[model samples]
Target: MATTPHAFETLKLTGLGRSFGGHAALAGLDLTIRAGEFIALLGPSGCGKSTALNCLAGLLPLTHGTITMDEKRIDTLSPEQRGFGMVFQNYALFPHMSVERNIAFGLQMRKVSRSETKRRVTEAIALVKLEAHAKKLPGQLSGGQQQRVAIARAIVLEPSLVLMDEPLSNLDAKLRLDMRTEIRRLHQSLGLTTIYVTHDQEEALSMADRLVVLREGRVQQVGTPEELHTAPVNWHVADFMGYRNLLDVTVTESGAEGVLVSNEDLHIRGTAVGGVTPGGAARLAIRPEDLRIASSEDTGDGLIVAEVAVVEYHGREFSVGATAKSGTTLYVRSELAPQPGDKVRLRVDPARALVFAADLDAAGEPVAQTALAGEAAT
Candidate 1:
C-alpha cells in the first residue's frame, strides 16, 4: 500500500510580479500556503487578485519571481503539467457534454482506464450530489448545479490544489449560501489545498481559513477573518475590512502623556502610535460594531460625545450614523433605534482601535480639498 502525500506542502511564491505594457499587475506577491490550507485572495476590482491566481495556475507568464510547490520550483511548468484544478467565475462548463462526461473528461485526457474512469465519474457525481444531474448537459443545469458540476470536474482529477475565482458570483443569494456551505463541506472532507479569489468580504470571511488582502498590485494584509476583523495593521486594511471609524488623527502631545486629536472633540488618551512623533499624520480606526452610543449617564474609557444624524435598523441590530461636535462623521452600531437629531455619546475601546501612518498621498487629500475650496471662492 502506498501512502498519500500532503495536499500541498509549503507552496511558495517569492517576489512574484507580472506587467502589461509597463503597467504592473501582480508585484512582489510573496505567499506561502501550508499543506492543506485554504487561502482566499481578496481585494477590490483591479487589485490583481485574479492575476495572482492566474500566475499560480500557470495560465499567465510571470514577469518576475519564482513559484515553488514543496520547494520544487514549477515556475516553468504548463497548467496541465502543474496539475492545478481551476474553477473559473463563469463555470466554464462544456455546453454539449453531460455532467458525468464533464467529470470524466480529465481522467480520459490523462488516459485512465475506461472502467476506472466510470468508477471515478460515479464517485465525483456522488461527491457533488449531482447523481440525478449526471445525464443532463450544462445547458440544462441551473447556475448553482452547473457550478457544482464544474467543481466536480475540477476535483475528479484528484489534483493537489484547487483554484476558484468568484465561483459563486453568478448564483442567487440563497444558492450562494448553499454553495458556500457545500464548498466548506468539500474543503473539510477533501482537505484540498485551495486558493480562492474573491472581492466579496462576507464570502471570504465565511469560507476561507485565511485570506490575503491585496491593493494596488501589492499585499496589504494576510490573516484569518477574526484576526483581520479584530486587528488590521493599517488604515487601508482597517477601511477595507469594514472598519467604519477610521479617522485621520494626529498626536497633539507625546511621550508618557500622549493625546491623539481627530477633527477636534475626540481627544483619545493614549499613545496612538509608538515611536512616532507628534507632527506626523496618522489614522485611528475601529469597526462600527465596536463603537457604542453611550447613554447620558455612561462614562467609559472611550467615549466620544456625538449626535445622531441617521438611523438604519436591522432586525438583529441597528446601524447609527452621527456627527461629532468637531464635524467628524461617526458611526455606531447597536440594538436601539436612535432617532434623527438625537444627541449621543459614543464609546470607542482604545485597545480595540487600530492606528497606522497615513499614506503620503492620502494625507495630502485634505490640503487639495482646501485648495479647491479656495479656488472656488476666488
Candidate 2:
C-alpha cells in the first residue's frame, strides 16, 4: 500500500467495514472525499460515524476494505504513518505540559530539531490566538482554550488532512458557536482537508462543505447541506432535519400532482416532486415553520386543518401541536402564540413538504444519545 502526500485529490474507501461477532459497526461502506474538502460525518450515537472515521484514520483495522489516497492504496499503514492530524473531543493534551509544549509534542516525536519545534509552536499558538496563554497547562486553561490548543497542535505538523471528533462537545453553547466560527475561519484560511465528526445538526449544516449522513452502518445520503435539507432521501432524514409534521397520505398516480390523505376520509393536495409511487404508502413531511395557523378556514385544495392541543412558548418562537381532521398528529411553529385548548386551523405549504416511505425502527425511534450530550461536562 502506497501513501499519497496531499489533500487535493480524492481519498477513496472501497468495501470498507468492521464487524464484531454478529454485529457490524460499519458495513460495505464506500466513500470518496476529495482533497481540501470539509465533510461532516453526522448520525445518531452508535450509528457508525466514529467507526468509519477510525477506519479512515487507520486507528481501526478494516474487516474488509481498501483505503486509497489519490488512487494509491494505504489501508495497511499505521495511524501515524497515515499522515493525518487529529483533535479528539477531550482535548487530549498532556495535563502537565504547557500549551506550547503540547503543540510541539508531535514535532518532537518526529525528531524535529529544538529550533524548528519552537518555530512551529510559535506559529501554531499565533494561528489559534493563544499566544498569551502558551505558558498555561491544560488544567489552567478553559475548555475552549484547551480545544484550540489541541487544534493548534494538530495543524502544527502540517498534515494533509485533519480529523476532529466532536471537538467542541465540552464547551458551552456560546463558546461552541464562537469556536465554530473560529474553526471555519481557520479551515478557510488554510484549505486543509478536514473530516469533522458531530451529531449536532447546526454544527454540521453551518460548517461542513458537504455532509455524509450515516445510519446503522450504512450511508443514508451524501450531499451539500441545502440538498439534504430540501430533499432528504427518506423519513429519517426528513425528521432529522426538523420536519416534525409527518402525516400519512396516498398517491393516486405517478402523473398526479397531489395526494389523497386522511383516515381514508379527507383528501389533501401536496407536492409529488419526490418520485413517489402511485397508490403507495406515502408520508408527507413538512417543517414546523412551513405550517401556518388560522382561526377559521374552509375545505381547500392546499391546506391542512387541525385542532390545537398544546402550545409551548419560547422567547423567539411557539410550538403548537394538534391532531388534524384525518387523525394525524401534527406540530407547527408559529409566532402568533396560540394556547392549549384553542381551536385553530393549520395550513402548510405544499412546496416545502416531502414524501417518503416509512422506516419505523431506523428513523422513528427517539435517540437516547441526548443524555450523552448532556454529559459533556464530565
Which lDDT values do the candidates have, in the order given?
0.81, 0.79
Lowest summed lDDT across 10 adjacent residues in model 1 is found at: 367-376
Where is model 1 more than 4 Å wrong at Cα? Answer: 1-8, 255-259, 270-275, 299-302, 325-328, 362-378
Superposed on all Cα atoms, model 2 deviates from the true structure by an RMSD in Å of 5.2
Encode model 1's per-residue lDDT on 23-61: one tens digit a residue. Answer: 888899988989788899988788899999999999999
TM-score per candidate: 0.88, 0.87
Q: After superposition, how far is residue 205 of candidate 1 from its true place, in Å?
A: 2.5
Compare the candidates by TM-score and give the number of the best one. Answer: 1
Cα deviation at 12, candidate 1, in Å, is 1.5
Off by over 4 Å in 2: 1-8, 249-255, 264-266, 273-275, 295-303, 309-316, 323-329, 360-378
Give the winner by lDDT: 1
Error of 2 at 262 (Å): 2.6
